[model samples]
Target: MRHIPNALCILRMLLVVPIAWLLTAGEYKATLWVFAFAGFTDGLDGFLAKRCGWMSELGKILDPLADKILLVSVFITLAVIGVVPVWLAATAVLRDVTITIGAITYNALYGYPHGNPTVISKINTLCQIVYLLLAVAAKAGEWAPDTALLILGAMVFVTTVVSGIDYVVTYTRKAIAASRAKHGLA
Candidate 1:
């Protein structure tokens, strides 16, 4: 019961391989279904964690890691298959990489860079998810228009840049403050 959220996160992570394989095989319809299922598990797990008090330290780590794996895998696959712009995929991957390096450095230098998702970060994630969903749907069923995808991609790009900057700026400030406090300069 309490571990349901963490289990769902693990399941989502495991789904990444199939999603990538489906995309590569040009089974867009199957890929869409599987991706949607993975997304649903993401939401379900978050809900269960918050509503059922099933949250744990492991859940905190696994949830975002699962999302990154799923999104990055799908984005790279879509780019390779010519379903999406390579720049979009590159931007997504780079943002994640930058954040990962920053988090690791901050954690090692100060302590765990503790925080919650900023509003912009949340919006960025939503844009990315919606864009990916539409991209898969367009490939699967021709339900999403290119114009819509273009607009969503732009939104994703903007939000991703903004959120990446926000994370760096916010955490850098925190790290500076922590350093000052440690040195009794505050």
Candidate 2:
């Protein structure tokens, strides 16, 4: 029972692969439903785990992995189909790669815990998702979807840079402070 949320997190990660395949196949209707289901299950597991005090470091780690995989895969699919700007996809992917590498490096070197997203990061994620959905919707020749995707893409770009920098800066400062405090230097 304690592992239930972790299991769901893994399931969500797996869901990304097939959902990307469906989206790439131009199955918007089906992809939409699958994406919705994935989101719902993710929410359900998180909610239940938090309420039951079953949340763990493991779940914290895996949940974000699932989210990144889904978002990156969506960007790739939409870009391949010419629904999204390739530069935007590149930025999204590069940011994820940068952060993941930084997290791994920080965890190994400074022994810092995995930090959850700040509110800015959360808003950035929503913008990214909206950008993806609008791009997917634009494939059917809707101008509104196209316009919204462009606007959201720009916002995603800005937010990505800001959030990524905020994390790195905060983590670096915290590490320094922790080291200083540990040595009676703070």
lDDT of 2: 0.79
Clashing residue pairs found in predicted model 2: none
Task: Give per-model CA RMSD.
Answer: 1.0, 2.4
Worst 10 residues of 2 by lDDT: 137-146
For model 2 the local lDDT of residue 145 reads 48
Q: Which 10 residues in a row give candidate 1 its minimum summed lDDT?
A: 109-118
Per-residue lDDT over 20-104 for candidate 1, one digit per residue giving the tens place of the 0 to 100 score: 9999998989988898999999889999999999989888788888988888888898999999899989999998888888888
Q: Write the per-residue lDDT of candidate 2 for residues 85-146, one digit (tens) a residue.
A: 78888888888888888888777766755587888888887788766656655654445444
Off by over 4 Å in 1: none
What TM-score does structure 1 among the candidates reach? 0.96
